[model samples]
Target: SQKIEQNSEALNIQEGKTATLTCNYTNYSPAYLQWYRQDPGRGPVFLLLIRENEKEKRKERLKVTFDTTLKQSLFHITASQPADSATYLCALFSGGYQKVTFGIGTKLQVIP
Candidate 1:
């Protein structure tokens, strides 16, 4: 069985700093790891994604890493702002597997 777990239930960071979030999996590695931001009463929005073969990926102020060996993925947001606060989720998709697994999500709060 494959499962995804966020490092923490909540993460607090000061604005203007980098906020790092962790997502760990067990049993099997996913072919792709996707990051999403979800706000209260709103559906999750896609942030960034990384393929199993890619070590790292970046989009604007967001960056993501996929490490199959550790069965983990990391998501980072640079120059964090209060508006960046949201519950972040990690989704896993396998190449031959039809099922998709999603993390419970970690709530990030950027304080001024």
Candidate 2:
């Protein structure tokens, strides 16, 4: 069985700093990896996606890296602000009818 894991605890950081989050998986090779941001009582909003062959991807202040060999992905937010605080999730897809696996998510809190 395939499994995805993220930090189970909340991460706290000062405003205007960079925040780095990690995602790890095992037992399967995913063709596409996606990251999302979820706020309390709301569904997740997509942030970024990286293909298995891609080494790194970026959009504005956000960046994502995928390492198929390690079955891991890293999400980064530069110059993060308090508004950036939310639960970040990582989803893995193998490109079939199989269900997408999502990590439990890691909560982030940015202090001013």
- TM-scores for all candidates: the values are 0.94, 0.95
Clashing pairs in 1: none
What TM-score would you give candidate 2 relative to the actual structure?
A: 0.95
**Candidate of highest lDDT:** 2
Q: Per-residue lDDT for 46 in model 2?
A: 96
lDDT of 1 by residue, 86-109 (tens): 999999988665777789999999
Model 2 weakest lDDT span, ten residues long: 92-101
RMSD of 1: 1.4
Off by over 4 Å in 1: 95-98
lDDT (0-100) at residue 48 of candidate 1?
A: 88
